[model samples]
Target chain A: MTKTELFNQIKTKKSYLCVGLDTDIKKIPKHLLSSEDPVFEFNKAIIDATSDLCVSYKPNIAFYEAMGPKGWQSLAKTLEYIPKDCFSIADAKRGDIGNTSSLYARAFFDKSASGMSFDSITVAPYMGKDSVSPFLEFENKWVILLALTSNEGGKDFQNLELAEGTEVYKKVLEVSKNWGDSERLMYVVGATRAEKLREIRAIVPDSFLLVPGVGAQGGSLFEVSKYGMNATCGLLVNSSRGIIYASSGEDFAEKAREEAQKIQTEMAEYLDQFLK
Target chain B: MTKTELFNQIKTKKSYLCVGLDTDIKKIPKHLLSSEDPVFEFNKAIIDATSDLCVSYKPNIAFYEAMGPKGWQSLAKTLEYIPKDCFSIADAKRGDIGNTSSLYARAFFDKSASGMSFDSITVAPYMGKDSVSPFLEFENKWVILLALTSNEGGKDFQNLELAEGTEVYKKVLEVSKNWGDSERLMYVVGATRAEKLREIRAIVPDSFLLVPGVGAQGGSLFEVSKYGMNATCGLLVNSSRGIIYASSGEDFAEKAREEAQKIQTEMAEYLDQFLK
Candidate 1:
């Protein structure tokens, strides 16, 4: 989806929430275990309950991959079930050398080839430009590059100061901007580091930022919108475990809807306060 | 497999050549397309031909992922088909946060959970210690972290000088050492940058290095061994297209064996000259 269309969806819904489908087989309600595809069934319920309250759905690929080939089948089914108006992200942290990365692009962006096509795929930047540029070859498909991750390991290398006085994450932002414009690119700036979002904005002012760590990771929604929001409300604040596993009983979907609604309500107020 | 076991295999085979199974559906011999599982059929032939010459096999995961679920099934079959003596490397450069990385560890290392258990899997160090540590949790499995890649873009961030005058890749080698010892850890020091191997060897003298960018990518095996070799002849130099696609006709398997034997012949000499 185009940035404008994504912005329009946020405007229409008065929110910029991207509910993460980090569904685990063992974590789903026990009652759903009888279903042929429990992961898909649980995701179907979550999507049905909370689709209107969110602008996108980011499925954590590792969860599905843990189930093996059968998990991939469930992931494909989940992708097909998502509403077309809502953006889909295959949160698969994939990257490699040039030719191999092209196949990865085909894997996530070419539905006919891999039986699933996402609007975007999360890419690791350790391999640099060629590793990330292949994903940009598909028109309108987004490449969300890892910038300052929310994890504790985020501090290990990303925070290291260069001889020129720039941190590695800053260097990633400065160099990668030349590879793709704001329309085709987005940076994943962790919500855990809301202060860094301001620094990130100075580098890529117009580009959207996918912010994880808002809920379960102890990142504040208000702080993220305060530092990260731009003219188009350019922030996809993701909440995975916070919303998906709100309950484990048969009313899990209803409980999930309530959690999403609460976040969306807070996001609407932030949009009014922060939107340029 | 353990480090001693791997070293023993190299000594017994008189080579450390790793034949990369980067099998693409479109790139494989078209005659095999009539089979029940063409990719598996092609990999089976390649494994049968080159198993004796090479001490290791590294399958580039992107090739299989592009074909989707069926491709994964073929990968499972290929993993099972590889002889126990040969070390298997899942060249899937995957890493995420701690919890997510654990799932990835299971996806490749826990065969019962994901139907594939490789001896080693390549991991990207962009997210730092936590992203890499989970893979080390698996017993006897390995994490080959990307240090200096062979691609043109490898110069992007890896070569940047740190504030303390150390290069980024060197810092990765230094800091990540604490996460896993030599027996469980390996570094991907690309063969194309053979000159840099001398410098890398300084930081990681004891760890085995998985060197790619040989053959098709124009890396010199002689230079790699001269600069990168350690006690136990610590190297698994990979050659993908040069061996596997030596012939596209019905004689593909026989031709592949010839290419592998030529590399093994050179590797044997390197072992005799460089083994400490």
Candidate 2:
């Protein structure tokens, strides 16, 4: 999905919230467990409840993967359930050698292989060009390169000033941006790093940012939206547990919708400020 | 598996090679296509032929993920097929928020979930302490953090010198190391950076290094072993395409065995030197 399309969705839905589908079997409502694929059932209900309110749905790969083959089936099925207009992300932080990475690109982007193609994917830039370039090979698909993350350890390296007097993550964003245009390359800047977001925005103002750590991670939505947003509403604030696992009982999906609505309502207001 | 067990396997097999299962459906032997799960069949054949020559197996998760539901089935089945003594790795480079990361840990390490558990997993430390800590929560399951990668873009940030007069990757190694002991943590130092291995080793002298880029990416085994080897033979040098796709014909398994054998011979020599 192109940045323009993502922006359009944000404008149309009046929301920039990306509801994370980090669904775990243990966390889902017990009543759904009896179903053939409880994970997918939970996902379908969550998507049905929250799709209209959110601009995107981000599914972390590990949750589905833990269930083994069944988890993958649920993921593919969940991908199908997601509204086409709503951006879908396979939050599988993949990075490897170039040849291997190219194949990974095919697995996620090419429907011929998995019949489940994500609009974007979270990529680890640690392996450098070969690891990241493979994901960028697909047209219209995005490579969300890891820059300044929301984790506390993010300060361990990303914040470190380099010999060139720039931070390591800054260089990552600078060099990685050259591999693909703003249309294809998005970055993952943790929502908690709101102040740092301004500095990051200074470097790649035009690019979209996949901002996680927003809701449950304690990153304020207003803080991130105020500092990081661009003209195109260039921010996807992801809330996984804060939304999906809001309730573990029969009303889980309903609770998820309510939580998502709360965030989306807040997002709509912020988006309006930019629209104005 | 502990480092001692892995080291003993290398000593017994006379090889330090970890054959990577970066299996691509398009690249597998044609004969295996007739099977219910071609990827699993291909992996099984390769493991069977080369099991005696190699000490561990690293399955790149993207290969299986690309195949979707069936791919995951193949991955789980393949994990089951690997010899019990051989160290297994789910090369699913996952890192996210603490809560989400905990689920990922459950997926890869919790045998109760999939009946398949890996000895280690590659993780992106960009997310910091919370992201990496979840993986460390599983006892005896090593977290292989990306350090100096072998890819072309690796120079973009990994090599940049940080504020503390340390390279970005060096800081990652230093700070991330604090989250876990050497026994629970390892760093990925690409074979292409053989010359710099000494410097990396200086910072992480006790931790095991998961070295890639050896065969196809032009990293020299001799140089990497010379400079990177530690008291525990702290290395798990991987060769994916070089071994798995050694031949795409019917004799693919035989050819894979030959390819792995060659690397094993060289690794045996390195082990001899290091053990001495």
Where model 1 places Cα greater than 4 Å from the true spot, the runs are A192-194, B191-194
The per-model DockQ list reads: 0.89, 0.67
Cα lDDT, all candidates = 0.93, 0.83
Clashing pairs in 1: none
Q: What does candidate 1's lDDT look like per residue over A220-275, in tens digits?
A: 88888988889999899999998999999999999999999999999999999999
lDDT of 2 by residue, A1-276 (tens): 677888888888899889988887877889998998888888999999999999889999878877877777888889988999999998888777687788678778889888788998888877788788878878889888888787776776667777777777888888888888889888998845566877898899988899888877788888888888888888888999999888888999899999998988888888877542
Q: Per-candidate TM vs. native?
A: 0.99, 0.94
Estimate, for each residue in B1-276, the C-alpha lDDT of model 2 and write its tens digit: 987888788778877788899888887877888988888889999999999998889999878877777777788899989998898888877787677788788878888886678898888777778888988878889999888777776776677766667677787888888889888998888744555887888788988888888898788898888888887888888998898888889999999999998998888888888653
Give RMSD (Å) of candidate 2 vs. truth.
2.2
In model 1, what lDDT does residue B38 have? 94
DockQ computed for model 1 against the true two-chain complex using alpha carbons: 0.89
